[model samples]
Target: MNKFGVLSILMVLISVLMFFILRGPNADLPLIIIILGSLSLLGIIFAVISKKWLSGVIGVLSNGAVLVCVFFILLAYGIAG
Candidate 1:
């Protein structure tokens, strides 16, 4: 596999880990978002540099999904507050 492929795999693994980590009541929203966002950005960058179009698309979709989840979490927190 190429560098982009490796990066894409790593990003997916990290995102999964973050998801599990963020499941607790004491989880930090901003921290989780930042970590996931960084991983997604790196994935996209690697995909672009390596000319891996499919990985690039997957990176975008995964990032968008994570962002959406974060958005809803924040929204719910705001409403509850």
Candidate 2:
């Protein structure tokens, strides 16, 4: 697969896996944020490891997807609370 596809898979997997594995409304929430943060960092690393602009494109798109997810999460929180 291309870099973008791989990156998307990685971040989405982390999001889903973390939610199921760390399901609690206490410390697990912040810990999950940290995990997502790490995935964002990995996106940067992947971009840098590439020899051309393609990797950068993948990183930007992947990070954008994660950000979109985080936005939805915040929206849910605002609505719920």
Candidate 3:
């Protein structure tokens, strides 16, 4: 797997784990979401730079998933408004 793919997978795993671990009544939730979003954004950039079709696709999808998760997390936390 390429670096982008690895990063994407890692981001996905971290976001999923964090979502469960920090689900409710957490003080660090926003900070975690920001960090995860930043990582996901970086993964997307690296995927675009890699220029490998499969890796780029996988990275984009996985990182996008994390971003989506972040959004939902914000919603659940009532912090997005």
Better of 1 and 2 by TM-score: 1
Would you list the rank order by lDDT, best first? Answer: 3, 1, 2
What's the TM-score of every candidate structure? 0.69, 0.52, 0.71
- For candidate 1, give the lDDT of residue 7: 80
- Once fitted onto the true fold, the runs of candidate 2 whose alpha carbons sit more than 4 angstroms away are 1-13, 19-34, 41-51
Residue-level lDDT of model 1, residues 16-77, one tens digit each, is 78878776888776677677767766765665665666766776666566657667767776
lDDT of each: 0.69, 0.62, 0.76
Runs in model 1 lying further than 4 Å from the true structure = 77-81
Off by over 4 Å in 3: 1-5, 13-27, 79-81
lDDT string for model 2 (1-81, tens) is 466546645665676676678666653444555676667666656555553576566766666677566666656656765
lDDT, candidate 3, at 69: 78
Which window of 10 residues has the lowest lDDT sum in candidate 3? 18-27
| lDDT per residue (tens digit) for residues 1-81 in model 3 | 677667666666776776677656645876877887887888788778777888888888988888887788778769543
